[model samples]
Target: MDHDHTLFHRDDVVALRHDLALSLRAAAHHGLGEGICNHFSVMLGGNSGLFLINPHGLHWAEVGPDDIVLVDERGERVAGAHGVERTAMFIHAAVHKLAGKTCVLHTHMPHATALTVTPSGKLNTKLSQNAMRFHRRVAFDADYNGLAFDETEGERIAAALQGADVAFLANHGVVVCGESLAAAYDDLYYLERACQLEVLARSMGGGLAEVSDQVAEATAAQFARDRDQSRLFFEALRRELPLP
Candidate 1:
């Protein structure tokens, strides 16, 4: 496939590349990445049918702006030096298309994946303040049909989201989607923290303390109103990381 040099060089596209690379690096820094398996992607801009994703075989820590691959809806690599991972194409493409998510982040970070393998099957949003941020904003896919080797599995997973921003994939991993890279990464980072807290609480062997539905809903509303915080958090990551 021919490369779109002009599109890649556009200022907004360049900035998005930087943001995506920074997000991958930050996820690795926070130990949220699992080798080269998990993937992150962002739509180019406003349903352009093109998106940016990290190439296969590159560790998240080493992915730079130039390493982000441009992939079209058909799973073809429009640009970048390396090929897209099969699952990355299937899962991300379906979510981008079917779910209409602008940014999709899929990971198997330990604490969150831990919850997936449990009988509870999802996060307890009313259990902790951090968890409250996701109140009524999570979906669960109880069916784990193995690796997404094709589009059908991907569509199934996307449909499983059921209009929620976060999805807990039963016995597999977690998917976090948002309107932008900053927003998605913010949710991914905090989701792990919330899961970590819950897992730790469970290990302590006492009855867990959960807040009332009214309190959880109120807290989530407050978080929803403070959308700028997600942008600020991503900016902080960019500043802290050794990106150039």
Candidate 2:
């Protein structure tokens, strides 16, 4: 059964489910996933009012697209035979509500999570590709206000993400949203890598060097030129896990 569309089709929903499962499993295999606390979602159909999110309390490796629950704009479960996470509803719902039908990935991956706890938490661009991809797309949340369980907190986060596509939830984790799951996953993957490198470099105690603004911008622009890069990255990651 197909749903109304403004930009995506039924196949797109299928593709999103497969990708989320693959991405989740890969994250689990790489020790990025933390039990069953994270959530990954992609917008389905053209209305920009609904999304597919992982079922609450399910491990990333076990989640399938078919297992993904469809949620409408108001955090209401609309499809699938599963329930959504409460925090996922508050956070992802608010994100989609403001960003419009977009894929949103939230996780408590190691390095990124570690960095979020620091007083001056930031995604230091010391790692080349990590630096390149994250350049200006990151938004840092300075306060860890516990689990997001209300529209107000969600709205605060949406406002924090004003012009960026990624956010580091202080004392919590990271959030990456995009026009597609491929793009969002690509960002989330590299974001963790970048955070890892930054933490490592800081441990060396010699400070870090940043790429010039011109160079960073040029690199990001080059990546943007290849719209298929996101999908390509996802495909490469799939080869590692190969299943949900």
Candidate 3:
């Protein structure tokens, strides 16, 4: 374990790690993690060549800035003190390679996973903040073979995510990727919240009704405008995590 600081000292990786750790912990705290599985990563520099990811088998709530493993664009461990998670490298590595996204957050939460098990994979949007974010940023991947280990499966998942900021992995979970960790985490958090609400609404036997299109559009615009404020949420989560 070469725990060298030089590899992660770059402003880009540091900011990414800090923000990602925060988001990971938040996801775990909100019930998005399955013990030690699930993973998150963000690209380094401009090439998406050296991304930051968590070491395998670590609880999401227990991860910190120093716990990240730096992996090259092809999923090979490039730096840092620990090794990469096999599944994470296989899935996220392929995504950054083919999709060219900077931030990728994958998790398995209860409500969202339930939605994926169905054929429709539809999330009822009934005017709540949860529904508003799901208006258009979400995508549903109906096919689930198994854990992503090959480039082709990862590419297929990425294809399902095309034009979608947040995607539901059929019979598995959800994946959200964005330009930054804050943006990605914000989307992930809201997606889970929305799913939880939808589950609750459906259990009552009354089908949910969506807010008018005009209202939905307006609320989504407001969420877009408040993107800057999402930074504060991430910051607060950072303060609560197990810092290094």
Give the best candidate by lDDT. 1
Q: How many residue pairs clash (N, CA or C atoms closer than 3 angstroms) in each of the candidate models, in the order given?
A: 0, 3, 0
Query: Which 10 residues in a row give candidate 2 its minimum summed lDDT?
Result: 1-10
- Against the hidden reference, what TM-scores do the models get? 0.97, 0.88, 0.91
Name the TM-score of candidate 1. Answer: 0.97
* Model 2, span 1-244: residue lDDT tens: 3444332236766777677778777778777888889788777665657777888878887876678777776767767767887888888877777866377888889898898888867686534666677777788877667778877767777778877888888888888888877787777777888788888888899967877888888887876788698888888888866763
lDDT of 3 by residue, 57-99 (tens): 7898888887888877667776777777777877787778777
Badly placed stretches (over 4 Å) of model 1 are: 1-5
- Candidate with best TM-score: 1
Question: How well is each residue in 144-193 modelled by candidate 1, as lDDT tens digits?
Answer: 88899989877988999989999999999999999999999999999999
Query: Model 3 off-target regions past 4 Å?
Result: 1-5
